[model samples]
Target: MIKKFLVFSALLCSAVFCNAQNAQLEAAVGKLTRLMVTPDSLGLDSILLDNLSYGHSNGGLQSKPQFMRSLLTGASDFVEIDLTDKQVVIQNKIALVRHTLSAKTNDKNIPGKVKLYILLVWSNEKTGWKLLARQAVKVPEK
Candidate 1:
């Protein structure tokens, strides 16, 4: 029937839309990682929401300005960052992403490595996807 055909088409369209949104979110995350490692101030400012809440495993939290300052001032220097096992779910204008982050950093010139489970919340804006929040928990060594 026409009704059934219409229903099928609607479902197919929704699935395709979701796939495209997921790809966009993944690309946003990738760009964020690159910007973090390289400390691109302009790129960072564009990609992060003004009210960003960035939480670390040590129970520390930073606002958007603080986070940007840390990167700009060499307080947080990432030599390399690798993200794995990423899963992204999109709901309306928000996307939730979970991933494993393994990174080498030089914080205040003290070199260190970290492995953490990260959760990132992105808000889809008119310009693009902006990082709204992020939390990281240390992953135990196996």
Candidate 2:
């Protein structure tokens, strides 16, 4: 009886821990999207790793500095964003996040809408969870 009880307790603890980790990762993802739409340099910098690989749907890849510059200069202006079907998987200090992103943009004063499958890699450090890498692929129109 005691063995079974201990086993149940362990399982329960693990489940709770997993839920908590997911919540944290989700919150971090939400913050990232919000910052993208608003273009908060300091806020975005706080959550991004120093060496970030940011890949776009156009087969273009950017470093952290380049990404920041584009966002700050209204070159990649995201007017609104919506994320759906988000999934987060964590292993040790790293996490893989996947979601469908639909956004309205005004890039270089050109209005557009985009739907993308986004994959974000996050690394948990002493400070908290930070974005390590991100890649986006264009989703086919229906």
On TM-score, the leading prediction is 1
lDDT of 1 by residue, 28-90 (tens): 998999988988789999999999999999999999999999998989899999999988888
Scored by Cα lDDT, where does model 1 land?
Answer: 0.94
Models 1 onward score TM values of: 0.94, 0.93
lDDT to native, each model: 0.94, 0.93
Angstrom error at residue 8, model 1: 2.2
Query: Over 4 Å off in model 1, which ranges?
Result: none
Q: What is the C-alpha RMSD of each candidate to the true structure, in Å?
A: 1.2, 1.2
**How far does residue 32 in candidate 1 sit from its true spot (Å)?**
0.5
lDDT over C-alpha atoms for residue 98 of model 1? 96
In terms of lDDT, model 2 sits at: 0.93
Instruction: Name the lDDT value of residue 123 in candidate 2.
Output: 97
Q: In model 2, what lDDT does residue 77 have?
A: 95
